[model samples]
Target: MRTAEQVTFGGSGLNRAAQIRGDAAALAQAMADPAARCLPMWRGKPLLRGDGLDALGLIPMDHPVLAAGLGKAIRAPVFLGLEEDGAPRFAHDLSRWEPEELDYGALGSFVDRSEQRHPDLPEDMAFAELRRVMTALSPRDAELAATAKAIIGWHATHRFCARCGVETVIGHAGWQRDCPDCGGHHFPRTDPVVIMLITHGDAVLMGRSPGWPEGMYSLLAGFVEPGETLEAAVRREVMEEAGVPVGAVSYLASQPWPFPASLMFGCAGEALAREITIDPVEIEDAIWVSRADMMTAFAGEHPTIKPARRGAIAHFLLQNWLADTLN
Candidate 1:
């Protein structure tokens, strides 16, 4: 689809510097260069230094504040990429800095709001949630943040080898984990999820989970089961959650959802029936709302239903559908 890359976290044609990742000598030189800059993530939240909503922030790699932290890395700093000017970029996960933890439910709630200030950095910087500010960020920044989050999150969880149950060491400039015992190498994993825009005439299928904020309904989604195609996953998820059979599934767009790493495949499917037999365990409620009502919800005018948050694939897909602009 034409709008595929317009989604938050879509690629921005950055040079990932893959060739240098495995070259120890080159990586060491780049790390020592004055052009090296890093984005520090604390408890999964990245530090920020922008005043405007759309600004991009960078922390100098040699800055005193980050120097001490880098020396004490939980692991090697993950190399992000080089900018157009060849400035090296890396992301450092500093969950150990001040001993704060990331609670998934409260991720967007400011990580360093009341923390002690460092003399080297500006005082007004905000470490805001990536999701809450994704729409406001440029596509490039969004992609950078998402990439950093996914790789760092992966390193956080995959500290040991699955095959040998042995400790693994970071390698390939943070892109790989090597296990000495098993002679195994592991890369970051991205879970595949299918989010369906199931439609019956003018209405679209949406559901709410038990713990989501009230009135926050979104496209019916589920992880793609092993050996399942995207279309099959979409069809299966809709049926399992809402008991609505789906047919003629087609791809729409995709988004990289990095709340601990997921690659969301947005799909459209034809709903064969409208009657919902709620699977109480999977979803709290299922409803088919006409395009008109969906518009109202999108505008935040619906009495009880709220639209999917902006910047999410659900919002993007629904907005395009409403305008008949899906390509």
Candidate 2:
């Protein structure tokens, strides 16, 4: 999809600079060089500035929050570039910052840190705040924020050695954590998830999980079980959720949905059958909708169904599918 990369974190061709991960001295030098910068992640939201919020927030390496986190840092920072403009950008952490309350329509301004301050911040801010801020960001910024949150969250949760049950220390610029006692190395974990748009002619199958907002639905998705291929996962997820067999599954796109670290594999599949036998344990309901209905949903004109989430691969794929540009 032409707009696939347009998602906030989708196609920013940021230079990840993976080769520098192993060179501690070089990494430290870069951070200290004054040219280096960081982006802020509040909860899991990337900080944005400016009118349309396209102005990505820039955080210097020496910022107080980054210093506190990176001073005892674990992973090397990853940078993303604007695919359209090729400009380098940072993802910062603003979890330590304060927030201002506003109406849903006015929420967009929260991504701009210039609207608030961090004075006497609490030590334990809820992750929900981050979600709120993230919801306010553009798709691409949300993706970047989600990436930072997932990575940082991994560091926080995996501080213990899985091999020997011992405390681990951060290493390799936060990519790996080493167990002090057992000599074990633990890396950030990204669980694989298969999200597919199952099309049978002009209609696509969508489902809603239990507790989702009324009328809200998305493509059926689930984790790739152990020993399963992506194609296999796609078929399994569709069958398990909607009770519909899928064939000719093909890869489409991907997104880093870092709500605790998940890589969503977007796919397209041919429906082998039309009947949906919903699995109450897996999904609340499953239904098929024609291309015209989907277009209406995307436009927020469908009274009973909302569009797939923005910034998510599901929404991205559906948007492209509607435009006939799944190339």
Candidate 3:
């Protein structure tokens, strides 16, 4: 897709300086430097400030919870030193504060006071407010949100040792966790999901999951199983859901959908058979819509079907495909 990276959370080329993950002194300096700033994550959502949504808010290392986590006795919390416009940026989770806004749906309701571990408090932040503020931010702010969400989510979940059932310690600048008892090293987990656009000539296939809103139809997607190739996964998923035989699958674009950490691999697949055979177990219904119909759907003119999500890769790919720019 020509404008794939133009999608929200697609690509902004932030320098994820992984090389400095092991440099304790350097990481400390970066965290403490006045120029150093950390993007705060409430639950899995990133904080956004300013109009254009272009202003990225950076939480300082001295914030109460973060200070505790990175104390000398407590070992420095894993932090990523990212670079934007030749300047350094940081990411951290304020899962320690109770966010004031709660109506932003699943992304905004992250208050977990039971953890008492101040780092687990949901910050007084709201996802919808952030979105509103970010609507006018510079491109860098949007990109910074993407990076912060991904890293903070990683920190929130990988707090235990997978091998010994013991509490693990953060290490390697927040990229790794070590279990002292088992000498085990753990890293963030990212699951691979295939979100494909299956097409037969001018029409494309789309469906809605059982739990989705009334008319919300998105490209069929499924997790890529162990040992399965992206091409094979596309074929299998399409066949299982719509009973369509797909051939000549190709990569389109990708997005980091960090609801809990997932890499959405957007793809395009050619349909070899068009006979409609909906798998009641996999999808509520399957439909083939012509280019014109899709354009209507995108424009909110279609009465029965809503458009694919705006910020998602599916919407991005479909828009480009309609414009004949999927090259």
On lDDT, the candidate that comes out on top is: 1
Local accuracy of candidate 1 as per-residue lDDT tens digits, 2-76: 878888788586789999999999999888989888877766666666555354456777766665554232456
lDDT of 3 by residue, 1-327 (tens): 566677666566777788778887877777777777766555545554433234555656676655533322124444555665435676665554553444435543322212111323244432333333333545566666755666556656667776778888877777787898999998778899999889998999998878676788889999999999999999999999889999999998888776567889999999998897989988999899899999999999999888876666788888888898999
Superior by TM-score: candidate 1 or candidate 2: 1
Candidate 3 accuracy as TM-score: 0.84
Candidate topping TM-score = 1
Clash tally for model 1: 0
Regions of model 3 farther than 4 Å from truth: 51-54, 63-78, 84-86, 99-139
Q: Worst lDDT window (10 residues) for model 3?
A: 110-119
The clash tally of candidate 2 reads: 20
**Best of the two (1, 3) by TM-score:** 1
lDDT of each: 0.81, 0.69, 0.70
- Model 1 — TM-score against the truth? 0.92
Ranking by TM-score: 1, 3, 2
lDDT (10s digit) by residue, model 2, range 1-327: 455556445664445566556677766665665655566655444545554444346556666665443412343454433333433345544444445652444344423233333333222222233433544665555655666677777766777889998888866665678888978988889999999989999999999877666798899999999999999999988887888998898888887777768888888999999999988988899999899999999989998998776656788889889999997
RMSD of each: 2.7, 5.4, 4.8
Clashing pairs in 1: none
